[model samples]
Target chain A: MSMTLEELTDRTGLTVLDHLEQQVRIPVVDGLQAQGDLIVIPLAVLDDVDVPARARWRPVPPSGVELLRGAAGGNPHTLVAEPGAAEWTTEVHDRQRLAVGVLRATRPAYLIHSEHGGSGIAPGTYLVRRQRERSTQRGGQADFLVAD
Target chain B: MRPTSTAGTGRRRSATSGCGPPCTPNPPTGNAERAITGLYALLGRRRPRFHWAASPRQAVDLLDEPPLRLGGPVDPAAPWHVAHQLADAAHRLAGRLDERAGPVGTFWWTTERIVRTRPPADALAAGVSLAELLVVGVRNSLGRSVHDGLRTPLRAALTEAVGEPPGLRWHGQHDAPWVAYHDVRRRLRPGLFHPDDDRQVDLWADIARSCGWWWPREDVCVVTERTGVAHTEALPGALHGEVRTHNRHGPAVGYADGWGGHSWHGTAVPAWVIEEPTVERIGAERNVEVRRCAIERLGWDAYLDQARLTLVAEAADPGNPGCRLQLYDLPQHVWGTPARVLLAVNGSVERDGHRRRYGLSVPADLDDPVAAAGWSYGLSGEQYARLLRRT
Candidate 1:
């Protein structure tokens, strides 16, 4: 029943990046959204894991992975719910806030904003954190820090 | 590995190691040919009774005897096996020794390294004198008992597989309780074996050698105190560091931390804590004092807290501007080697006064913080074990 990342993507009808996302269980935050390539998974979902123990932050790219946004000025970047995926209920305080996560795989998940051209954000489904509220500057992209 | 007779027993038994025909010197057609043939024959058989000779000439003479066939030398690392056999024999001898001859703790400590680690090959090649080490080992075991003619040939054959006796020195009763010394500055400081105190002096050597001198160097400590004594009536101030409690059997149970008013059984006594910078020469007296003060003041959990924090601080990426990275929690217990961590990066803060548009990326294969901290503290695996023993 074991398959490589490519095979899992082919079998499950998920993108290569989505296949990586399927490797780790991510938490669901009510009212939380994915801005740019950013996604929020509650820390509680990691109850069975010890991510904080080693204190590592992994980054993945924000390109190509499918995500559904909230309609009509709601959370601009929210993930479309996956069928049969296990979900946990948790609260998110601010529209834009700091959050943490671990990457499920390394692949191009989203396009990098023009401003971050000098900084290397590899293509992958990253464990990400919402570092802060997205800047409201003109043409500024809602950016999330992703680390693997 | 049978119970062998004393070395003094007038009996000889040899393991059938299939050595070829007895060495008969060929008649000399020429001095050089005869010498070469003799050397080849000597080199061909594996003879076992060789002892550590005091002089080169004596070693050569010993090798010249028929029973002393210098068959191909055993593996260099075989000295450990040799020392194991020797220790087994010494253990038997310990039962015959007088109580005054001192407990077997001193003997076991003395032989710990020799029996546990491989001796250098050159030293093994030079040959070990089991006969000599046996006399010394047996003498120490006897304590005040006269050497009851135990150096039997059967005893020597016990070391047939192992070539040489590892270098060990026994100080015996003259040094009293601390009767053995190993690895130069180290002392086999023996106190009475107390079941309640849980101090197994024989095993102490393993911990000591395992960690070197990193653990606390106290002769005894109050590992646990009996409940219900008035706080004021607890371990008296006068009996602090050197206090030793003996059970009904008259064996010392544990030592007391006079300052903290707690007693520790042997098992509870922690290893030396390296608090000071100067580790080169930790005086024995100062070592115990420092250990007592530390345990009484900081405690084990506090030390772990500090150690973890130190790891986090040291792992920070100083080069990244406002590059706030920290370890959030410990890795799973099963995780080993270079660890992957849940890193928290503060993207809010500006480094070098730059407001960046994009968030930071996490690096791969981060440096191991705990290892770095241990090195910074100059703690070895054994010293680190002290901290783990508590947690």
Candidate 2:
């Protein structure tokens, strides 16, 4: 009872299996993305089947492509997320997200307090404060002054 | 790419590359060409590695490589990448050195340029100091570190990619803790800044080349040539003319004021604050003493209070650099050019007067932050970062 991807697409909205009841496998496209937990049921036996809109097939980010390279290329071993990676989740958005973030080295900065040494004890937390001050032209920021 | 052993028989790995062209060399002919070709043949030429495959797959192509957004998962400019990069650098640094040298606080900063906004003193009541800076350096309310996923290999690769001359690096156990420094002053010449120039380089860029002096210079201050000499009218005072940018921008060099004075060198910064007393650098020991007395006599609380009313206070006791140095710009930071400065004064009372504006305003870039170039003329973290960019 094998079904064709075209026939399956007609029956269901899913991207159906291209092949059925065979050992052959199809390669994943270069930039195509996998949503959530990916289970490839090769339609060769079933893997190549067409699943409908059950999952979205969108182009992944260049970085994401690298991150999920194996899954995209049908490498079973590499497809598994890194040990502590979060389960894959699909996100739909209206506007593009230009999210920028930075991470600091949190593990307490090493200080020389008894544990390390003493004689050379010199520096401590060198706290640097950065500010954005706009200097005006001509009189230069006459606006910031309190009226005389 | 695989973990290949160097002792291989002429076999090198290769990957599909879409790069427009390959690095070319002089096309040798005749004897020379034959000799080189024969040598390559004898050595067994193998395809070189091309890691950053536009396609996605591995976290990185191979060893000593890093992964960042190129195509999909995240915006190339995501701060997450910055955070991660910092964290990665710190992690690497920690791994390299003895962790027992107390906790190391890696100071990461950046800078940018933009049309200055003459925001009144009241507009920005908040100015940063050491204690407050401590908080900003930490992770936000989110337990995640602020620099959690930022990837800035550029900063790390600075030493490796030397253009003119190799940048000067000062490394040693500062107080037994490993402190490696590479500043701008080492590579650049002084007297590079021309206050008259409009398109000037930011501060930190210059410092990256010299001043391995590590951030806070012992004695550093910028005074605009436009107003260094005392008033042209000798007035009743001595012939010492009065000079003052009045905290304005044009030809005005915001001096970095610190005994252990801090140098602002970065692409961008958050904020910078310089108390009035800080600029008065007479002698090394005297300077430290005066500040100690100033903070003590003025009361630390009063200093904090003036945190907002900067202009008024700076006016009350305008920065006096004795005789103004025609060298107004910060040579260590600005890379021989003046800077787009922002002024945020503590204290209060508002009334727009003469000065126009300097430094970048948030209006240009939606995501860009609004910040001062240091409370005075120094570059903020963001400003410093901007200077680090290649010309």
Candidate 3:
């Protein structure tokens, strides 16, 4: 009953990962700092990340997960969070020929979206690993698979 | 209305205090000024750094990492519009790349098509339908007028910048053109897959572009430079890792050596099996500080180094486990320091199960084999990117 989130995800089933897909919410600062931003935090000063509140997705080939980098030369931007009708939420689509994992990061103080897809698992979402507090060298609790 | 100063002008200043100095209203602050003032008040102290950092485009691009066009703060909604917006943005951006490239049509849109779905009772895997895979690839390369969507923007931008339509390279394949080399990207990537009948993947048969050539692949092998388990604890020695698989699919473990090439124990899923954590493990042991300092900087080059004096030094102690390390002198990885690494994972995932995991010890940098066997590892930028995480 008390297995760390990492343990839960380590035993990740398609069901569980899929379930978290619907849980994607607006990314909290920590999620961005520690994860989303963490991945590409330094690609540059990150001049801009003008994602819209809503987005449409398609799978890219030869690789998984790319920010709609842009058509040949036009500036590329990704649509991200949206203020939902009832609450805040986000979504991801499998544009690829096959399904793959999507990573998400969130905090406990905030609310993430609830699962609504037909499948019990929200396939694309973040799974917590080792959550650390920014202010101190302490451990915090984490939930698995927060979708981006 | 005047303040009810009836008896309230307790100080009884003078005639100068008449009507509170004519109700002199200070000029109203503009919306931009008021907004700024309110922000400062809410924040309490003036954050000098934030002021400078918040200049025009600074923050906008900060959030501009992936999932294009709708580049705002990331969200959790599964909206149809979000996908459309990003695709549109991608089309726009692709156009710009061509504009910047100049007259040669140096740019092109590549796509792939594969069978991703299988009937439940068909006895095949969940995503093995090649036909489905092909459909999805076309959808990506041509769907939503993907090519048109992207090409128009590319052309306008190109014509503006240089003056020509970009040379095009469609990565996907449909019923047309039947046979020619495809884009190098079509070479086995694992992440992009879908069911044969998924609605999103169906447009390929109706609208698709054909290509004349496939990307070239190499059957190169990266032999490990060091040997045995202790090589792991030796810090620097551990970084010298490598492995050789069929230039494209999975790992090369459990293979029988043969000039004709060998077979491997694998997931057989037919995709790129990027073991990013394993790449980090090498970084953890060899350059823990760097890994901690900034992860992005730890490219493959960092792992490739001369067999450090230690391994050569280990030769003196044939009895030392470190000395009996595996040999990775592929003529391909003999660049700069002449360091060597081989990707070696347990040949079998389960002692009894046939599935295997390969631990490829790639140089943190690109070190080409120095031999004349025309040996090139042919590692793609994407593969190198696979090993890295945002630092």
User: Candidate 2: misplaced stretches above 4 Å?
Assistant: A1-134, A137-148, B1-20, B25-100, B103-391
What is the number of backbone collisions in each predicted candidate, taken in the order shown? Answer: 60, 171, 160
lDDT of 1 by residue, B178-230 (tens): 21222111222233323321222233222222110010001110011111111
Q: Candidate 3 on B42-122: residue-level lDDT in tens?
A: 324231111111111221222222333345664434322333333444355345433432342221122111121222223
TM-score of chain A of each: 0.26, 0.16, 0.20
Candidate 3 similarity to native, TM-score: 0.19
Q: Score the docking of each candidate (DockQ).
A: 0.01, 0.02, 0.01
Where is the poorest 10-residue window by lDDT in model 1 chain B?
B212-221
lDDT against the true structure, per candidate, is 0.25, 0.20, 0.22
Residue B286 lDDT, candidate 1, scale 0-100: 37
Q: Name the lDDT of candidate 3.
A: 0.22
**Which candidate's TM-score is highest?**
3
Q: Which residues of candidate 3, in runs, are more than 4 Å off?
A: A1-3, A10-45, A53-148, B1-258, B261-303, B307-391
Per-candidate TM equals 0.17, 0.14, 0.19
lDDT of 2 by residue, B1-391 (tens): 0101101211111221223222111221122223222222322432222112111111011112232334466443542333333234434543433232223234333200000121122212333222222212221111111011110111222222332211111111110111111111112333322432101122222221121111110121110000011101111111111111111111111111100111111111111222333222211223232333333223333433443222211211121112111101221121112322122222111133222111221111122122222122122323322221000
What is the alpha-carbon RMSD of candidate 3 to the true structure?
33.3
